[model samples]
Target: MPTARESLLNAALMALAQLPWSGVRMVDVASAAGVSRQTLYNEFGSKDGLARGLARREADTYLHGVDRLLAERTGAADRLVAIAEWTVGEARAKPLLRALLTGCWSERLPVPRPARRGAVLSKAPAQRRADAGLPSPADLVAAVRDRSLAALEKGSRPSRTKEESAELAHRSEQAVRLALSYVIAPVGEGVGPLVRTAVGGAVGTTVSATVSATSPTAADRRRLQSPV
Candidate 1:
């Protein structure tokens, strides 16, 4: 059987999913978990503490997927779209991801804003400092996509024909931007899926060499020739 602490945490996570973190209370969590408020207090110390734990538990899951995505040799544009789509899926499902997408938990709960402090505000200051060298999640995903695309091009051609360079770069930039817009902060309502789909389309166009011969597309293609 789960311990009272585990039960309370699980209840807290569920409540956070359905309602804003601020709307959740110890009494509600306790009631949902079939435990007493006192038990919750004894285990988590405060509402903020419970909220922090819940956020971390969810983030752990998110990072795992991101890590796997980065490790793959998928095309750059595909990687960007995959990251955005993954983010959208998580935001639609996980409370923590939704909180990130909605930017609600930062207001109600004590969850750390990654962009604000560089480290998840919930993490210790030392940890944040240590993580400062790493790119933001959105940026990291963009970089990975950029690298993967460049790798694909290199392996396919001894040297890119000038025409190919022009077309590919244009589409790749659009695709990366599309992915970043959805994954990053201030994600407006109804924009997530739209941006992801657009990114996917952009990737398809670029990878297929369907873009017109133009300077813009050429630049975008060259940009994809490296890790962002």
Candidate 2:
């Protein structure tokens, strides 16, 4: 069973699918989750806290998928490509993910407006307390990049020296940044191919050689090469 926090977050997401974030009410979310309004406030502090918690939960879901690919996929390049593909795919499918990743809100994801004077605004004190738990967008991005780099290093061939390990880590960070740039704005090419090129260039390897060494079948290659 989902915890109260999880229930609230899921309710928020469901609300997001139906209405813009700005239009979602804490009371509505609490009711949808079958929890008291006070329980919601206790868990998330404020609307901002709930928004941040939702973003964190979604980011965790995406990163968990990336981690699974890192563990199951062979070769650094292959894993990097897979991660990029997943990121692009999720961002395309989920407006909230796209906004969180790009820091830009589209029509599908209007910015959250402040609540007008009413019962909602009356709960300002509790909301202010919870707002402290929210992480900045930059913090969220940095956390994802750091985790990705660590996964790359763990799966990489053992470095001969500390300097080599550091270099590989740096390259991994660069690979993630390059992929994110494309995620923010595409260049009329498939995400997988673009990511493959970026990762290959960063690590000084050929994409084909990386894929072949991993022994991914035709279907797997097709899946990677196809646009998200």
Candidate 3:
């Protein structure tokens, strides 16, 4: 069963779907959640608090998805490619997520702000968390990078040297940054090939072999051989 907090957040999201944030009233959200208006207020002190809650949820959900996708048993480059592709798709589908990732909030979004300093804390733990402020686009990129690096390193061979480990982390960040760029600009088609190229080719290849010349794709050949 969904908790009252979850129910209320869902109600608010439903309301958001129907109207802009400015048009969404607390009373209506409580009514939609089948909770009292006071209960709604109790969970979230104000509309801004509710917005923080929603943004917190969006960020948590995105990171959790990244964790799950990274857990998949695949080659390292392939794993990075998978998460990059997923990030683009997810950012497109979720408004709060897109705002969180790209730091580009539309008028429809609440654009969460942290709680006022020296203010009384919310009795709700979740609300306190929301009050802490949401991560920026750069913060999220670093998070994705760290998470990707950890996952890739964990699955890698035990004999890896410090330099190789550092290289792995670098490639992971490289892939994540590329994904963020795509999220911001959104080049046509998928983001997979570019991400794969950034992280090097194939699953089993080492970082030393990255930007591989053994068998470059036609496009890779063009890019490498280009004088411009």
- Output the better candidate (1/3) by lDDT: 3
Q: What's model 1's lDDT at 192?
A: 36
Measured by lDDT, the strongest candidate is 3
Cα deviation of 153, candidate 1, in Å: 13
Q: Which candidate is the best by TM-score?
A: 3
Q: What local lDDT does model 3 show for residue 22?
A: 96
Model 3 clash tally, residue pairs: 0
lDDT of 1 by residue, 28-72 (tens): 899999988877766555565565556555555666676576457
**TM-score pick, better of 1 and 2:** 2
TM-score of each: 0.47, 0.69, 0.87
lDDT of 2: 0.66
Better of 2 and 3 by lDDT: 3
Question: Tens digit of lDDT per residue, candidate 2, span 89-149?
Answer: 7787888777777778776553444333342332434344333343445655566656666
Q: Which stretches of candidate 1 lie over 4 Å from their true place?
A: 1-6, 17-20, 34-39, 70-73, 101-177, 183-228
Q: Which ten residues in a row have the lowest lDDT in candidate 2?
A: 207-216
Please give the ranking of all candidate structures by lDDT, highest first, separated by commas. Answer: 3, 2, 1
